[model samples]
Target: MPRLWTTRLLTALLLALLLLTAACEAEPEPRRYDFAIQLNGGPTGWPVWVEELTFDHTWWSPGGNLGGGFDKRPPSGGATAVLSRPMPAPSSVQARWFSYRTQTFYEIDLELPNTDALLQQWYRDYPPPDYRHYLMAGFSGEGEVYVWWRARCTVCGRDRSRDFHAPIVESAWAEEAEGDPGRYRNRTQEYVNEGVIPSPW
Candidate 1:
């Protein structure tokens, strides 16, 4: 009888440990927010192929980007990706893309406008429970990156934002373009400006 009791106690202890581990593992991670950026191919770099892109932000996922949306593909002269990240809003970012026209990979630093204040404004007016915030950053073929702040209600399609014509601010290239020595710079700004975003803004 004593031996049976000893065995049962050992079994119970093992079962308790297993339950504790399972509970710890079952705990869900914090909810993540959504954000996106659009990388447009400048005049000289027609149809940029984004190999990888990332923003300097909190731990949301591995490899900087979610590895979907526009990465590893050509944006046909203009494209961007919607990324998920913990944020106020990322102001600094990096892009490594291959220019098919240039036939070389170029890494450029992208500077986005800071919109934390706008985000705060929207959050105060549009509570998160009923609304979600979205950021739209556009890289102009004219060599300017424009940013916009928008909020939309989850329940309804209703949304509010400052349109492309009036972007919060345009981000400039913190780094100079040097790699591949392609049309990205050889072309005229006026000509580049003539190119429009293939994807709907």
Candidate 2:
């Protein structure tokens, strides 16, 4: 009888340990959002090359995450791109851009905002019908992120080129609860004349 009781106790302990390990190994819930960016401007005679584009972000929970990439494309006659990511918590996203010709870098940081109030205002009346023209939308996680306008030539020595202006727009909105496969409402805003492209070289 003594040996049988000891064996039962060991079996119970092993089961409990397995359950605890499974709970700890489970992945945290994910917060989902949609993002988009648009560039506005006619065109600069000098070639416009995008050497790099990167995104650094922190989620709402304890741990943070990073996403984004580099694109080697010459943006002419305006450009647009859309992306989406799953975040563990309310987060902040930083965007970096490097121009090869001008030898300059541009950066923008956006912190996710309260959705309740912003959504109410968005339903009332969407501000700036042409919000895509502005770069502030990138913060919201959706909408136009930037507009690139070339003022002068940066490559040729004949006429000294002025600093290029690359608008940085950010926009985002909260979807359904974690694990829900449904779309949610969204709102976007633009930052007026906020982006300043400075030359590092």
* Best candidate according to lDDT: 1
Q: How would you encode candidate 1's per-residue C-alpha lDDT over 77-160 as one tens digit per residue?
A: 124444544444666566555443334455556666666665655666776656655554433223343345545456664332
- Listed per candidate, the RMSD to the true structure in angstroms reads 10.4, 18.7
lDDT for model 1, please. Answer: 0.46
- Candidate 1: stretches off by over 4 Å: 1-45, 57-85, 102-106, 111-113, 139-144, 153-166, 171-201
lDDT by residue for model 2 (49-150), tens: 222233335321111111121121223223454344422223344443322223333344555444434333432343222122211122111111332222
Error of 1 at 146 (Å): 3.2
Candidate 2: segments with Cα more than 4 A from true spot: 1-28, 34-50, 56-78, 84-90, 99-103, 108-201
lDDT of each: 0.46, 0.31
